[model samples]
Target chain A: MKTITNKKNILYSKKELGQIQLLLPVILVVTVFSLAPLLRGIYLGFTDYRLGDPISFNGIENYKQLFSDEYFWNSFKIGMVWTFVVTAIQVSLGLGLALLLNSKVRFTSFYTILILIPWATPPIIRGILWRQMYEPNTGAVNILLTNLGLISAPINWLSSFEFVIPAVIVAGVWGEISKAAIFLLAGLQTIPNDLYEASKIDGAGLWDQFRHITIPVLKPVLAAIISLTFMWNFNTFGIIWVLTQGGPGGLTRLPMLAAYEEGFKYGYIGYAAAIGNVMVIILSLMLFMYIRVQLRERTES
Target chain B: MKRNIYIVLILLVGTILFFLLTRKNNNHQNIPLRFVSLAWQEGTIATNKSIVNEWNAAHPDIQVEYIQGTWNSAHDYLITAFETGDVPDIFHYESSVIIDYAMRGYLTDLSPYISSEMKNDILDVAWATVTRPNGEVDGIPFLIESLVVLYNKSLFKKEGIIPPTIEYPWTWDDLQSAARKMTKDTNGDGVIDQYGAGLGLRNSANIIMNTSISFGGSFFKKEGNHFVVKVNDEEKKLLQTIVDMLYKDKSVSPASIGETGAGMIPGLFSGRYAMLVGIGSWGRQQLVENAPKEFQWGVMPPIKAKTQTYGASTQTLSIPKKSKRAKEAMMFIDFMLSSKNTARLALNDWMIPARISCLSMPEFKDKIGGWDITCSAVSTLSIGSWLGAPGYVEWKSRVANPVLQELFAGRMSIDDAARRIEHESNIVLSRYKKRGEVW
Candidate 1:
């Protein structure tokens, strides 16, 4: 009788049961779609899971192979370099453009709209457009430079091992700067007018004002933007694929492109899963860094 | 609140159950098969769709739905479909990938279904391309195309040079001298105004294989339990000849360093290149459409080194193993590959007919500018299929492509490139060896 009473007590009331029923659909969807794939990907990293073959546990075999794989290491190193260089240039240019736009300039609205054009254009289209523009003999850039008497010969931009990475970086920056500028401009507009007036009254020059006032005020926004830029640039794939395909001796190969080649092109699902897991860990580290910076800023304030 | 929640739960469950109960169930008597094809040429795509629609109109019980696929994404799409078990019943894919699919056990062997009459109707090489080592026909060849040298007639006339012909195709040295003669800088400009030839950096593997075969040297030869990478003196000499043309003579177009192979067509049309080597028969439509009205172009067999052999890229249609409507699919394949239909497709498009009967069809006898030479070259050439190794896709894309690109870009030496390709290709081939797959 006591056990029966306990079972009755454990059962939910009508209202509680209704609440649980309402949330069940969302829980099921997440479990089936999101959680399951994530768990499977993790599990496959520990197993040899070639497509159409029976998966078997291989412990850390995939990861061990990756550690010794030269292509994997080269791609990772290049990925880091590309991510850092592209992000740094994008942020600096964005900040500079924001400052220029924030000034009392002519056609401010027109300039803002023009600045948004690259941001609005799709990345894939931008990659193709830039690839054409970088062509050596007939490209518009070469034509202009030749007319300007800048150089005697057309430079092999896309095919040259030395120039391919920088060429892609320039294209990446051109496509990305507009969004970064817009984001920074939004932050700039939120600065109170009275702060700038007080700084001017204190005889602060432009550089001094920027260093002391703007930088301090924009720190949080800049941190967010930089963190997001790092994440996006680290995972960049489509543009590189369209432009170079990591060619001319794999000079521009990135970790994401390598992962795609391994998984989709080569059908090495286990190896690709291991690479993907490593990327996830790296991204998680970046997120932790972002959080730490935010916490530091909060404490400082 | 409890009553409302109860009402919502009941409604959702009832809706799902209603859908489950009312879902359309296809009948066993009527079989529907899906056929996917690449949008290779506009005319070919239209003709294929028309053929399928006609088949559907006549056959009520067995139907095939046509799905168009783009060249770039079709490989990935097929792989994804196979993974999900949603593959089409009949799909057209490149011959290079058919071996991979066959080895993976994803394709049905059509050996028993192929009638002896049909076997005799198709070209021996075309039939051999689709057959596995175990003597199982996994696919039916749809279109056959071979690479040939196309020269600008006006340019040759202006240079007072007789172009290569089928009876006496230019040897490597003869071709080199012709290129040098054709290359000139009009208006005394410091830069070259006309190039003698344009060779593709990406498709270098195909050209290399063709050249090596012409010189009687097989680059990839099957040895005991593995394939040996042997680049003999003849192959080395061929590579040296190309390097000399590009770097020393500077007669070959520099478009490889500027534009991709596919993107070099406009250059050829604009008279930038006097000769385009290793251009396939499919390039005729593009030339006719894009070239200047007065531009005169003629085709010849591929240049010879020591022999006259040619490699053909034959795209085929296959039936997946998982398909349930295999018989219906086989019927559809037969209808499509019949002599009349094959000739119709070949006439509409510039593709050389794979069927022996279709080669003599009235439609193919008409004088299309490039068809005669291309057809002759494809049918008579005794070279084995190129890039048909077990892991040829990887070897081509990863090893051959990049190594040649590096060599062309002047980043790596020819010896280094060859060595790296052999090493990397062997590594890739090892994957298949571990699985005990026959090349």
Candidate 2:
């Protein structure tokens, strides 16, 4: 009689309890896969654990070593520069293309589809194709350049320290810009045509209307795109790895590549984990700052 | 409706549980063995397919499965697999990585399983790579690779330059002069249409180490139980000379520093380059498939410096420590290394069989062109040693590669590069020094 009364007085209503029971599979999946791995990685970061060896606690030695390591810092610097430059260029180009496509031009859909090809293709395939195009000889770019008398000789686009990073950036942007453009195009569709019509009737020129109406209207979309683009560029590894392998004297070495070399190639698993942990922290900080800025802007408006 | 949904969910969960339990039971009964490899080439695939068929045919109780991985990400994937305690029973790895894996205790020691007769049949240098300093063999010798000069016979004939003979093997200087003579501006367009050689220095450390060893410069000197890098006088001289020949002499293409996509033997293939220095394994393949019928190609012994020559160490097969079927894994390795099977695999794979008897098999000689020369070059592995140290992998990433790149790009002086490598390598080495491990 007491047990029946206690069950009846439970916080969850019968319907709510049934609903909660239905969510067990989702909860189990999150716990087993995502949460478990995250916890394991964090735990291993503080231990002197090799891949197959008996793990031992090492406190913060791995983290300390990372802080002092010149290579790690260099890679961080490269990652930041890469993230900023690629994101800015890709976003602006995407927005510009989006605006152009938004116009009532003939074959606009066909042109948009063609531009989307790069984004639709796999990143690995895109990287390989771009690498071929950037080849020093027999590549389309060099052949075209030489034929047009733009340059007397072929350029080693992915070979030199100076050119390799920029070459990778161009390839990365090629893939990313298309996606950003499509996203912005969708955002552009949401803006009512009457807003532009009203501005034009009031004798507003293209630049003024774009700045006052289109730019303000696209702010949220632009912010989201920029932040997401920055995250993507920062985490990019496949394109750079396939193209350069961070070569020509480590000019294009990024943090992820460094972490990879440390963990797998050299068997410094703990150190690699520490590098990963640092990346998580750094990326999280960037994300937080982005959100904070967005909130601040919203508050000010 | 809620009761009906709950009943459906219960049934689904029960079905999934039953399936998983049955799968687990089936796995246990069969003792499934998985072989993981990243050898994507046609020959390697053929060899793997044949091996799997043979293994399955021989062992009725045991079954084997194969997993394919891409070369670029295979090592990383394997490492993750090992960390998660899900390693394959057998895997292929380069000789350099064997030590790295062994040090991490990820490999099973195979010394006890290997017989004296079997050990005697394997080449000493190839065996040495798998053997730890304490005389524990960590892997089975799969194949041996040696460096040989691959030259375009037609290009040599066209230039009226007699190819180096077996009796009168060319020296490094002789090869360089020959290459300079072969290089030409065929179209007279002021740009060189033909190059003397196509040297790939993009993957620098391996090439540099091979060149250094051929020039008789040992990167490390064995002292008691340990090895110390001797980047002092002799090594520096060798490093400088190679850099000078590669960049200053311009015998190799200037574009080689940045351009490797034109293929490893582009010059030889396109009739633009006269000579290429590459692994003997390449010569074996050229003998079988790649050699143009219009032009006869031949192998020259590796160019002699102070020492005879050196080649990048070939890959070996190892059983991961986490493998449940270690005994069966050892048996598979033994079968793979057996004279009959090795010779059979070698015939198709176009690599020097690690087994001594298989290498001497006359059938290999008749199968392809230039095999005679390649076999001879490979046999010289008796003289040279594997080029790796305890921390050699890290040294490669931090010092050797970057320094060599600087050398190739003409950004740093050879002496400066050598000094930098020495300093950086010591720092890398010191980390392992604490563990008391030796190269």
| Interface root-mean-square deviation (Å) of every model | 3.4, 3.0
Each candidate's DockQ: 0.47, 0.59
lDDT for model 1, please: 0.80
Return the lDDT, model 1, position B357: 90
In candidate 1, which residue ranges exceed 4 Å CA deviation?
A1-33, A104-114, A132-143, A146-156, A286-301, B1-31, B362-367, B379-388
Clashing pairs in 1: none
Query: Given candidate 1, what's the lDDT at residue B26?
Result: 33
Kindly give the stretch of ten consecutive residues in candidate 2 chain B with the minimal lDDT sum. Answer: B379-388
Which pairs clash inside model 2? none
User: C-alpha displacement of A197 in model 2, angstroms?
Assistant: 3.5
> Model 1, A9: alpha-carbon shift in Å?
13
Docking level of model 1: acceptable
lDDT of 2 by residue, A17-79 (tens): 778777866776688789998888888899887665688999999988888888789888999
The residue-level lDDT of candidate 2 at A188 comes to 92
True interface contacts reproduced, per candidate:
0.55, 0.81
Task: Encode model 1's per-residue lDDT on B338-361: one tens digit a residue.
Answer: 888888787666778888898776
